[model samples]
Target: MKDGWSVFYITKNAWEEMLRDINNAQSSIYFEQYLFNDLEKGEIGKIFLEALINKAKEGVKVKLLIDSVGSTDFFFSSETVNLEEHGIDLRFHALSRKNILSNIFPNLYRDHRKVLVIDEKIGYIGGVVIGQKMEHWRDTQVRIENDFVPLLKNSFDAIWNSLEKTSARPHQYMNRHLNENAEGFLGNCPREKDKALRKEILSKISRSRKRVWITTPYFVPSRKMVRVIKKAARRNVDVR
Candidate 1:
């Protein structure tokens, strides 16, 4: 955290590995997810719940946040009471509001993050979540140590701190420094004037001189992203 990012890890079998990290945590633990499925979801969910409860009982200062809309199983469910009984600091984000405006656009605003940080030393970020529905889904889960971790910690803190705000702000985001190092976190913030991340990616793509590789199970690129990719291809930039 005090230094810059020095290590990076991309893991496919993330849940098992991350569970080990959580089990070994001696200090603090931060667990936030978009889909923290019910403990009955499967063994994965049950073990993680047990691990967090154990850590909290040991006074490890465990904090858990989940999206009320995304993690419908955990929000206002009896399982929430179980976690709270163990002294876990559990909170929900993007709680559904009872109004005409909220009902129409409920899908537009929801926390879609899956992150796990153990003792502030290791962090796991990706699309993976706990649930039987996601058991067979492919995702990119990264485990990293030191350097860039502080950035993630800060981002988590920001969202955690502003849990009550009804704005569509994001969690961890990437800047130039982070992008230049290796991978970058992308997020959209309504509070920002220029929709910063999109602009930054456009600028980066336009200035590419070597190669560009884009991969997604879902292909729904915006018009501007399509333009940049096409422009890069015209320049023989090895765009994919």
Candidate 2:
């Protein structure tokens, strides 16, 4: 399944590619990441804030959603001021202390997705987070152009809609036309014991004919999944 996809290995100079894409975005840019950095202060963050601000100035609709806990400093400090000054709608996900009860119960459910959707057509998703640390950290990202963009957009809209009433937008693009043939949503929630997507991933790996190359910063797997991988390895399958 991954064969036809063009994989680009970005070691240190991958920022240029991301910047180039952001620079060329025409209509809108929707970014969601675990962290964001202000480039002016040399935080080793994804130094594309300037370009994002420039794009907004050029009449491009820009919306950035960053995790409040993961990007605590950038969210609370003045680092995000420039982005707001240029008409970019910036939001922090689930960083409020007022909701003490909810925070205590589901504090681990942070927005771990690193997604960038341009013009509601091209989508980027992967393990890459935006920051100076990302420059040195090994990571992987995929550029997708299939019918899955609407699903991604809907996921973002769900989060945006659940914000405080004052923080909610007018749902301008939420109901806009989407390309046909898009697949169903691939949702993930750690609290859910079923974990359908995770099961599907393990099932695919067990059925693969070629070598299995897993690359992830976090490697916490369930006991059933570990058994499946062990079984595959014992079957003389190439597992890595």
Candidate 3:
């Protein structure tokens, strides 16, 4: 594992760690998510929102990209205005009622990634979202550090540049020092065919010495993969 590399088992703990990182951010914070908003008045949601606002007030470049469908209500609500007022660069993805047909098809192709890249040296990737319900879900996340930060930073830049914005600020965090040697390729669904993470897991299973334990909330394995597991079990390999 890299210097900043860590795993969070549950969503609530993940969010707490995320907020701590956000509070400590010195230069910039870039976030992309599937959903975000306040469900109750002056709730934890508001606290996190205000934290971003305060960071922006302190000259930390705060930019956010949210999926339109997942955050549809928030995108059109008054809350968005407040976020914008605090100098938060907020952009909604592919949302347009004028192009209803195109929007309908792309609804399935969401920005499912939950990413928080702070100071361009620390990056967080996970299944957690900015919502109360997500706290109850069993999710996993990774904190990364190293050369991969620049690649992640470049990806963020590409997405930011592709969006239409009135103003764009430089991410000073990109100049921050980093520890740990990290290198990995970006993986996106629909756009990319091979799921690198999936392949990695399968490879680990194939190389297992003793019992192979597997756990997933959703277990929709392919027929071919099922056959492999059955063959492994028949060969006196203990698999659970």
Top TM-score: which candidate number? 1
Q: Please give the CA lDDT of all the candidate structures.
A: 0.73, 0.70, 0.73
lDDT, model 2, position 185: 50
Query: Candidate 3: which stretches are off by over 4 Å?
Result: 96-103, 161-182, 191-215, 228-240
Instruction: Report how far off residue 81 is in candidate 1 (Å).
Output: 1.2
lDDT of 2 by residue, 16-47 (tens): 55677789999999988876654554444635
Ten-residue stretch with the least lDDT total in model 3 = 169-178
**TM-score of candidate 2 against the unseen true structure:** 0.79
TM-score of 1: 0.82
**Model 1: CA > 4 A from native:** 1-12, 100-103, 165-186, 190-193
RMSD of 3: 5.8
Error of 2 at 200 (Å): 1.5
* Alpha-carbon TM-score of each model against the true structure: 0.82, 0.79, 0.75
lDDT of each residue in 145-239, candidate 1, tens digit only? 86667667766776677674564444333333243565545555544455766787788999999998865567788998999999999999998
Residue 116, candidate 1: alpha-carbon lDDT: 82
Candidate with more favorable, higher TM-score: 1 or 3: 1
